[model samples]
Target: MSAPSTVLVTGGAGFIGSHACAELLDHGYELIVVDDYSNSAPQVFARVQRVAGRFVGAVYELDIRDRQALSAVFDRHTVDAVVHFAGLKSVGASTRRPAEYYDTNVGGTTALLRTMHEHGVHQLVFSSSCSIYGEAGALPLDESVPARPTGPYASSTWTCEGILADVCRHRPEYTVVCLRCFNAVGAHPSGLLGENPRGTPDNLMPFLAQVAVGRRDRLQVFGDDYPTPDGTAVRDYIHVMDTVDAHRVALDHLADGPGMRVYNLGAGRGSSVFDVVRSFSRACGRPLPYEIAPRRPGDVATLVADASAVARDWGWRPSRGLDDMCEDAWRFQRLNPYGYEGSARRPGADRRSDGGPPIR
Candidate 1:
């Protein structure tokens, strides 16, 4: 499999997925994207087109679990590979709605795998999470550590990876790369594309951005009495661009052989919640208001990545820092305070997509 030319990107309307769509298009890969817009918006492809200066091959608004719709996408497009990003990702929501998470994450993955098998597409890049690691272990977590998934979200990701591994084992032609991503933050840097999650955001940076834009009054710092220097839970926040780059690189690496591989995709550094708040404040040109609160249950002290393996193997490592991430995120928020629905409409696009070939 010499670098795949056509890729089907699930969840292409969401934050990281949308950025990845633009990146893949920039690299001259045709994309067939699908997203239900549950947590995302449809107007993102306009910004994606603005960024890439090229339209997507096709865009389908449907659930990945729909074998007919998924197969229809494969049937219509010459999909050489698949980039799986469609699923419920909120850790808190996953716990509250474990059944929904399993049904969407686990069930959707199975549906996707079966559809791919039907189409004879054996190369896949799965979007997994470092949350599956559960807690900090040996300072910076590595791939060698045994998975100890805690919540439903992490457990679902762990299960998906297991299923992918089984697929590779049973089917010799399968080549899969499961990227256990850390906190993926930042915007497109163009100020045109960024995260705009529906309802209240479940992630820290987006919530902080919302507050900075006056959509919310103040942020609630989870804890300020942790063992770390900042006395707050720490996480490895990798830029969305770097994370997308790793996906493209991983897709190329699959050309090496037919086997299942796992890599920790992160910045190999940790930043506390306070650190992000302070940096976000700098980006917004003001100190964002905040109040310390009790530590949320199941929160960890540190969740940095030992990303040396990916660096050594694919020559991939995050290039953007916290300041860069915050600056871009703030730019997107500042440009569109009310998110996608309320943001200024692009020149040739309204609330809907940018006129790609529809699924129907």
Candidate 2:
């Protein structure tokens, strides 16, 4: 039999990346994780090994924008495909720092693509977002809808999709699968890994988890006067594991043929902000404190996914429900109140001053 494919995972030390690494390793694929640790803690590599029961091939603390350093990683490993997940991903932050977002998200992607071309590593599963759909005219947004990104972060992803499309037009050998994911919440069920954003948490799940664990005083309900069932904005929150599984399936689909493909990865159901808070409160066994605030600028009323295309084409489906998402998220937060940084201080845990133990 042929050797297993070696996948290069950008931002592998982050929230979703760490789960992806665990999944990839469990499936017997080699991993070369590259991350700058700018938005993630490096301790995750160790947890990945523990979860997978094997060592990753390698881990490089390098930025994707650094062409030379990234090229060196390519030289050292026989990378077969790439799962690109290393980009600035905050919508609000993107609005404030559009130039920085463009430089990192678009510019970094440009550099990574160039280096991949130089090395002839063409297969890529890009981590795109549904925010690119902006305020869609219809509910249950599908891949066929015209992209109308509203903020810099979403625009950066939209720009990358266009670049990949153009690149594919010129390079038929390249296969790119853009997974326009909806909200990715929850941690791995093992409670070993979860979303651990640096500084204040931006996403609702993490913020809610923090509040439940007393890391934060209360939750901030952004809006409750929108035109929805509960007057709050609604979104499709997919468990992180489900999102990671979609990436794996995308890779397999790409291996079968070489062409550009896009899929919406979501649960195909909408849950309002109040819905999530109630779910999380049940998970934590108490009512979490919160206050309703005015709707933020550019906030969409509802953003659900059709997700029928992926089911039809790839036969992929999300098995986890909203309750599973809440329970797993709270478990991770309750266990690691301070995240991986706190993991080091646990009894018998090997603590490293420079971001956990070295890879493997």
Count backbone clashes in candidate 2.
Answer: 0
Can you tell me which runs of candidate 1 are displaced by over 4 Å? Answer: 342-360
- Candidate 2 lDDT score at position 8: 94
Q: Write down the RMSD of candidate 1 (Cα, Å).
A: 3.1
Error of 1 at 18 (Å): 0.5
Q: Candidate 2 on 1-360: residue-level lDDT in tens?
A: 122289999989889999999999998888888988788877887788889998888777777898987887888779989999999998878888899999999999999999999998889999999999998778889899998888899899999999998988898888999999999999988888999888898788999999999989998889888889999889999999999998987878786666688899999999999999999999999999999887666568889999999999878899999999999999999988998864332233222223445322
lDDT of 2: 0.88
Per-residue lDDT of 1-360 in model 1, one digit per residue for the tens? 598999999999899999999999999998988888778877888889999999987787788898987887788778899999999988878878899999999999999999999998989999999998986467699999988777899888889998999989999999999999999998988888888888898889999999999999889888888789878888999999999999988888889899899999999989999899999999999999998888765566778899999999877778899999999999999998888754333333112143545454
Steric clash pairs (candidate 1): none
For residue 47, model 2's alpha carbon misses the true position, in angstroms, by 0.7
- Angstrom error of the Cα, residue 81, model 1: value is 0.2
